[model samples]
Target: MLITEKKHGIRFAQRMSDLGTETAFVVLAKARQLESQGRTIVHLEIGEPDFETPAHIVDEAVRALKAGATHYGPSPGLPEARQAIARYVSETRRVPVDFERVVITPGAKPIMFYTILALVDEGDEVIYPNPGFPIYESVIRFVGGRPVPIQLHEENDFRLDVGELLDLVTDRTKLIIINSPQNPTGSILTAEDLEAVGRLALDRDIYILADEIYSRIIYEGDFTSILHVVPEAMDQVILLDGMSKTFAMTGWRLGWGVMQPTLAAAVAKLQTNSNSCTATFSQMVIPPALFGPQGPVEAMRAEFQRRRDAIVAGLNRIDRITCRKPAGAFYVFPNTSRLGVDSQTLADRMLQEAGVAALSGTAFGRFGEGYLRFSYANSIENIKLGLERVEAFVAKL
Candidate 1:
């Protein structure tokens, strides 16, 4: 007898239905498939850095591995790694962060997952930005919390509207997710904006999860953390950051969270039950990556700024497409509403016809329907080529 669904019962739990996916990875697979079929795809679909890991950071990890540093570490993280994160956060944010408050995970994502799991009760609400990271909503729903989306307007350059966000709050609201130098849109929230949000969270006694993974990838101005603005509300804030964007260490899978010691204990317990701990050698890389030469990171940011400028200019010259120069990150969310096609259809047509791999804005959320997101993480030549293909495809419409 064949093993078939009809012959054997196989079902996912109820919460599985509510879980969503990050469509960038899905588009990447399709792009790779097309490439395997001999199509030349200019990939702007994923947000990963195109650079290699810095030499020093890689050397540190290698040294640790060679010296037999591979062992089961503490659930929260190796003590030295946690201490380095504490120092990094304290110095950078100008807020004193105790080492006890830091918890390391495989990547920045687990911080999001663990924070939601530990804090959100079923029926509690989480207010997060739409056209934001899909996993924010995905993990929110996975843990049985209601996801309340706050629309990010293109007119406002995709910054979160504090007034509008205030309207979404309810007694059941447990946490608010803030992603500055945000994904997809690449907008940075102002210090005043962070102050307002911090005040709201403090007054309402709700938690604020600040996802600042892209803090080191900024352009044009200083990057501000919520903790910097509201050090008084340290207990109410959870800071999420990682080496993926900064040091081109996505493959290394190292990230961390900084919170109050009590909540850190809770998140660490969750880590114990789940991932146990991050890799020991990877943990050893933290001190060097944070305190080592800053030259490599600055070079990457400068290059990304160059790519951002080129992509924005190219997209603007195309008919019916208007793009804003993002303040940070490596994405340009161009408005395609004037082209009279839904974002998903436009994205699909671009991929199938033009060999350009980009994401429909709807992949972020329903509010993203009129837009499309293209990561400028590729080379300037590839970015220009993708723009040409997009323009040619849009002209046909």
Candidate 2:
């Protein structure tokens, strides 16, 4: 029988207490609870893509399963799958992606863990964005690394201030995280900005952990990848990417980390010990997904662009809520602080009383205070309804 607190008085490790969680999942659970109580919630909380995984990718997975590809495989990933990822990254980042330097994991998440853990010793300082993805902060803390947050500016359209970022770096700083077409804010860093960070990392000999999951979900201007910006300094780079956002394959749980050969080998060993590779059948479908026609992918991006416009326009109509037009990704973070209300209160009231689901900006970071994130990943009808209810609720308050 499995040991449990009830049965054996199990004392969890002390480290477990230090771990943090993604509040999006917490908000999702609460939304579900209210939904079960017969509330009609127009969900704008989670960043999930409501679209189905493309038919071609689905067909490939089905074919792989039928062909008896359901067993455990190499932890670093199948050779053909790695080659396909290498091709995609090489084309997108303009860096010569070595297939051997790619280590496949269940999702982009594992790459974050592996890369951070591989580079960060206890007491090492890591610089990540404030008001950025919550998991980056959570994982750094969980691993005993000192997380130094660089506050992203709203006046700068949520772009990282190169001066501020460089000032925070010190001898203790080991890694700096770069997430373009970033989460929550949907801000894309400029190519020049990326090159500046690359120069800093090169001078300090610090690693750059680049999260480029939403590279293909871009709408305005171009997506400037870190590898493409400073290809010469790639030795200090670790690229994290996957199919979840781009291909609407969130549940497929497939992602890869591209790094120097030594780090890739170490990550593979870590994966072999822990995750034991992505599902065998999922790996079989990756090459087809990478090399196949991209009509469905382009269609999805166009639709997201349309939704992005609707949400930004709708939120702007509410005088108290000022949402910037995002360049990429599918979220709009509006400043609700103009109304003299905390983000948590506004988000909870919208869900519990107004039947609209949204996340408080504080759920991301303290720097995200005075803001609220609304995901446009849902349908246009629902996005309109969700924002309408929010507008009505804010009007009453």
Candidate 3:
């Protein structure tokens, strides 16, 4: 019966067996492994910005290091960083933020983990968007919460359907997750949608977690945060945002969650007990990144929009590929079922044979079965080359 028959074995917690993962990382690892063997992989799989963190933000971190700011810091982050974040959030989201309620983490991940662990108890229903971030479902299941998915679709322009979403909400739902400029599909939830969700959350006494990490990356119209519409959402209304997407600082591992005082305290305590705190030098860069000159941010956004246009147009030009121009974020989800291969097989064939890396729609959820998420977070040159390879690959199929 193998090694386990000996009973000298070690085993993981039952919950460990139930956990899911972000397939992006798995694809990234495969891409890296292929690259190590001298393969020229055109990466369109990962969501990280190809841009560097602004020099100003980098300078601040250097300054902090030179100033001997390295040490264990406050669990809720430095006062200065929190205050700067407060101003930044208040200005961008059009909502007043309490600095005391902000908890900075090593990355945006722990904020999700802590919030889910703190709020979701066994068997409670949690509503998250299908064809959305994999982590939301993973966290819910890890906590033993019943994950209820709201199916997103291309016909509705991938807009969050309030009626469809609320229909899934029962008295048992403890949390509802909303992500705009969303991952994989890059679909957005409108202000009206947010307002409806806010009303439902308030009426049902459900907590809301809005992941607005890509708020600054909008291509069309104005960007709306949950703050702009969900102020009255009953559950402390945790808002997660950070430097990773907006500032192209994913490697920095800096992000935060804004919440009400009570919940913030629990998160801070979680930070103290578990994470302790984020890096001091990283925390020190917030003011510069937030209150600095707006030129770099604007320039990067315009470039991303240009790339978005190129990729969407290019993908649509490929026979049997249908892509909707996303309103925000740096991804375009294309329906590839017309090619007569499942998304996972298509992704693998493209990566291994064509040297183009992308994520399968099934990586997100069952609703994403016929799609593939192509990230435009690369240069126009690379994006075009990758699509050319994809086009050639599809032609063969």
Candidate 4:
């Protein structure tokens, strides 16, 4: 009321306009709105795992809380948590990782945000996979960096071409981001693909941010990490991973980054300025989640594989819509271009008419046009029901 009483308006920073958002949350709100009006929505719009967090993780959090783990921890993270993550990554990737290089955060997005802030100068170019995570471009632009997109073509099975990526690099290139098993398209980068990018980073002295959050959810073959593929480039690589995807602990808001110690120090300083530290009790669960029995993780992965098969088959059976079986992650990027409208319109229609909530491909990037992303993180019954509704909607078209 005080501000409204004045004739002048408050001004937001110009950078606010440059920041984009994850469209899944927007669709989620609309889906919830429709549900309030008595419609049943089969939600595949959001990427969160539908399963509960395994009990052991929750038990650790409760135990820690009871033991007075609620106080503020170090800005970088609790030392024990970082050490645990280091050991876990070392054993899995087969590349020795120093605990000193790991920095924990409230969630993985903070790592992404802090990284761009730490490395990118104004007007510097950052190459990232288009139709990848929207936050990658959003943070880059927010920090006044030029976003150079390396398109991931569906024909190439949505994998980034190393030659194409290198073509986009210039004197201004400072950072390159690669996500795999990637978001939206759900494509895993091959060992050969990882090696090519790693070698390029080594030669050009560019930093690579490898988003390996879904590394534990692969359907075929052992998951390959960039650190394993090119151990020499370890100093130049920043790994973004967390318990969110693997442990179904998205709401726990716990994640960490592994990078060169110097950069980790800088990112840790940024963490100090921003979130202070991830919640103490949340950080307490990291050790057990990483070292405990991995059965729950494997169970979820197996279930996701089953759901992936069901959704891909059901989507392909629909007239004019074809979906690729994703090698990892819980999403399926289905081509809906054969229909008359663009991605957003189809997505809107799917929600309004069919009560099936999903995201437009363009939500990820412009290259995402003519496609739509659906997270198969829902149940088989919901996936089947959503597919049926979408089939009916398409038939009416």
Candidate 5:
């Protein structure tokens, strides 16, 4: 009787039982803890830009707050903000979008989730890229949809094979996800690939979600959006873009989704029920950010290009590592298999032994086993130091 005990806590939803997670933040937290203990940790694990938000953007937010823009606005977003987004998309991406089709959310992630929720049903097939953003797969599973992987090979510069992708689509497929200037690998989809997939989407009447968050961070050839190839896809295509990457406004939580009117309404309903709306003051910054002078953005892009060149050159000098100069985005996904260790093991050893923190390829997907993603969004000095530490660690091994 004395040993008898009460029952433990009740079970949570079974859908959440096998949910996956993004590992970038976990590695970031561990790096911070190590730094707190007096360790000099060179962080290459996170995807955030190292620069501050532009002064004009910040000032706009402050002005909005002071001008009494604190009240709850529409759940979809402020009309002015939506109009600015629409205009920006039309001018930049060449996609003629009506302002009524735009829905501003807290960040790009919400748009992904909302789009997935609207299209995916139980057991419905959804195609997404492996070695891509982890959240795409996670959210697909969260909504009881079957996630089909479109394998991206390192030999192909991590770009998707459109023929192979189309071969995997079935009659039950409801949605397909694509990311350009992709995360982790930083591969940009080719115009040919985009055209093939765009035609497929049009023929199959399937919904397409294009994650173009890093559209402005390219280092080489012109950056292209799928919207450019399929201008008529304004209704079926949902384009996700934001100030987070382009303007370094991650903390501001400003992002907008461009979709057809009906889909936009659905997403707005979701917002109304969940987040209510994005922060009022943040919405006020969209106009200035969209139409302001392009000086800061160009400066940041030039700096990122320099850092990319430095990291790629340094990694190429290491005998045991192979990396390509990423076409866009602020990451270098190098194949670490020549080091005689798996990515996760190498990442763990590097963090604890070399005082250099980075993300394992396994954190992205199973296809990412032999690679590790190093974000070059830090200072050039830090990038050089991190590579040196990594080289030393490989030598000792």
Candidate 6:
């Protein structure tokens, strides 16, 4: 094989240069490398659950495949799957969404990207949480929108301050992204905060992108949705969720977006130009995942709670390490400022010296500079060992 450079001056979009990336997969690759070299690495990097997909859900998918439900269904989604999602949202979250307004996609990420592309324009502004999901910023920049961050601080339990968020919004602000039981920090937005955001969205005539992917994974109080507080805002709000986090079906590549009919049609057009539609068999399994027995989801939540307790308690015991007990999701964002080093240095030292894999909080955004994110998706035993390794590493510092 010969390697040669392109002869012509190949032009690329300038926006591509400003795009960012998610670092969880990068850390996961490094962890696998260490494991291959005979190092026993306990992975707490990626935010995936340790549970298998519920038996009934898997069986449903198999049944669909065997029944020859493998042809391309619809550009938006199979009508049945869309209706199931509409019912699930209405019954579970008390969010009234019409079936015609739902567009199913391969995963939540694609919906997010499409939403950014639809609302963002050159020099427009998009607001998102700092130390949050990196893709929010990545896609915003990919669409040539200026990313304005809503800084979620540890003092505030990583919750978005409504007033501060509103202050950042201006006439050019096209979209605001909100994530509850958020990635990395695992902080849930309070009902009051949601109401405040909804009111602002209504008053400002700005669009809201509510990411409820982890809505069902809460360990504390009831899960809330922005759509519940301001139903009229539904016309301007886009809700993105799926079976990935709730049903432990991440690899199945299934998710759906809820928006107004016009916005849904626009996203559907984008989907038609891009992926066409989610896999037919996967769409066939969504109804069972949403309406079937929910015991497996509850069991997964309980296990995550156990691991969360173990890791939080263990980190608190370790010197020069401080971790807040996350109220939802499967991550613990701990302040490593007491260690007198940045998050990246601490993460590197932990991976290289202790053979433990965790993400540098800074990888999410600059607001995460002095923190590290530990995903509690593994077993209790592995969490214990990982904490032990972290303790040893911190002690040496």
lDDT of 2 at 362: 84
- Estimate every model's Cα lDDT from 0 to 1: 0.93, 0.90, 0.89, 0.94, 0.91, 0.90
lDDT tens digits by residue: candidate 5, 4-75:
564666679998865788899999899999999999999999898999999988888899999999999999
Query: What would the per-residue lDDT of candidate 3 be over residues 252-307, giving only the tens digit for each residue?
Result: 99999999889999999988999799999999998888888878889999999999
Q: Which pairs of residues collide in model 3?
A: none
Model 4 lDDT per residue over 166-197, tens place: 79989899999999999999999998999999
Q: What tens-digit string does per-residue lDDT give for candidate 2 at 33-111?
A: 9889888888888887899999989999999999999898988999999999999889888889889989889989999
> What TM-score does structure 2 among the candidates reach?
0.97
The best candidate in terms of lDDT: 4
TM-score-superior candidate, 1 or 3: 1
Alpha-carbon RMSD to native, per candidate: 1.1, 1.7, 2.2, 1.0, 2.1, 1.6
Regions of candidate 1 where Cα sits further than 4 Å from its true position? 1-6
RMSD of candidate 5 to the truth, in angstroms, is 2.1
lDDT of 6 by residue, 273-297 (tens): 9988899999998887878898888
Local error of candidate 1 at 376, Å? 0.8
Instruction: Point out the worst 10-residue segment of candidate 2 by lDDT.
Output: 1-10
| Per-prediction TM-score | 0.98, 0.97, 0.96, 0.99, 0.97, 0.97
Which segments of model 4 are wrong by more than 4 Å? 4-9
Q: Which pairs of residues clash in candidate 5, taking residues 3 or more apart in a chain or in different chains? A: none
Cα lDDT tens digits for candidate 1, 1-397: 5566366566878888999999999999999999999999999999899999999888888899999998999999999999999999999999988999999999989999999999999999999999899999999999999999999999898999999999999999999999999998999999999999999999999999999999999997899999889989899999999999999999999999999999999999999998899999999999989999999999999999999889999999998899999999999899999999999988998899999999999999888999999998899989988888888888999
